[model samples]
Target: MDRVLLTKKGAEALQAELKNLKSVERPKVIEAIAEARSHGDLSENAEYDAAKEQQGFVEGRIKELESHLSIAEVIDPSKLNVQGKVVFGTRVTLYDIDAAKEVSYQIVGDLEADIDQGQISLSSPIGRALIGKSEGDEFTFEAPSGEKTYEVVSVSYDV
Candidate 1:
């Protein structure tokens, strides 16, 4: 049970999901199971089987969320005192030296990392390279494609 990092927003999102599962989804699955049971002929009840399966899935997810939330280290970028250094939750814009284009990514916890949404996992190669970088700093890392170089153009923590 290693502790996992979470952004404030990411923790909130997980909490919201847990709440929904408990308050709404759990009740719905229970009702559906009960209704399916009432249909009789348990051996041939497809609805009952499906409802039970859904219940199992919902219950498993609830447990997972609870476990993750229990050990989560929620970090709010706004409350940080990092000055201008790039740390967790800092949104950094980089100038791709070879590509000659500006790109930006928000360093987020692993569970909430979505590259499609411009969020990169803190353990990711780019994230590791960008960590502790101040504005106007240049660094290079071995990208999966090849060695890539980037210059830190800006670092921000937007509330």
Candidate 2:
């Protein structure tokens, strides 16, 4: 399987979630399952059914987290020699031509992307266009509404 790329902060967040699942959520579900089972007649017991369903969800998440952590390639953007070029983990400030507004985004792995938080996946349209660009570079990408043009105002890996 191909390794999943993650920034230091992303990896830590995932690790924290995994720890919570294994140490807290997993055990809590197990206890619920046990308590439900004690009521007997699982086929007709609502508590038992709900607990079992929750257990499935918790277990699935745990497996997914384990799989990701096993092959995660954690990169610290602050330590990279970006040399003014935009790349994964770089925080890029852009000037939208049509909107005439400035926006900031951090190129990150798919799993860590949160557009509301100014993080975007490297494979995303705008992210792909910005990759390898430097300060003052301009690029265009197809957006859902239409084509959009942007100029790279600045690129920083200070994070």
Candidate 3:
């Protein structure tokens, strides 16, 4: 199978979620199912059906987390020896010429991309354009609205 890209923090978050699912969510769902089963009337037991459905969702999430962790290629930017060029897991600061403001974004995996948190996936348009760009470089990014001009201000690999 193909490998999945993940930042160090992203991988840790996924592992924590997996652990919570197995240790907490799984047991909670199992207890709920047991309690519903004790209500009797297997044919018309709405509580039992709901509990079963919740169990299915929990189990499916567990499997998905496991599958992702199995193929995860976690990249820790702080430990790398990359130069000034922006890369996966590195935070890039840019000066938007059109907007006349500065913005920062951390390049991360697809699953860890959160626009609200200033995290962008490496596959995203701006992220893809930031690759190999160094500080004091001027570049044009094809934003959803239109082509925006931005200048690279800084690149940091802080964890």
1-159 per-residue lDDT for model 3 (tens digits):
667899989999999999999999999999998998899987799988998999999999999989989989999888877889888999999999999999999999888999999999999999999998999999998989989899999999985
- The candidates, ranked best first by TM-score, are 2, 3, 1
Lowest lDDT 10-residue stretch of candidate 2: 75-84
- For model 1, the superposed segments whose C-alpha errors exceed 4 Å read none
Query: Once superposed on the true structure, which residue ranges of model 3 sit more than 4 Å away at CA?
Result: none
Angstrom error at residue 149, model 3: 1.8
Leading candidate by TM-score: 2
- lDDT (10s digit) by residue, model 1, range 14-45: 99999999999999999999999999998999
lDDT of candidates 1 onward, in order: 0.92, 0.91, 0.92
Model 1 TM-score is 0.92
State the RMSD for candidate 1.
1.4
Model 3 TM-score is 0.94
Instruction: Tell me how candidate 2 scores on lDDT.
Output: 0.91
Residue-wise C-alpha lDDT for candidate 2, range 13-110, written one tens digit per residue: 99999999999998999999899989989889999889889989998998998999999998877787778899899999999999999999999999
Please list all clashing residue pairs in model 1, or write none if there are none.
none
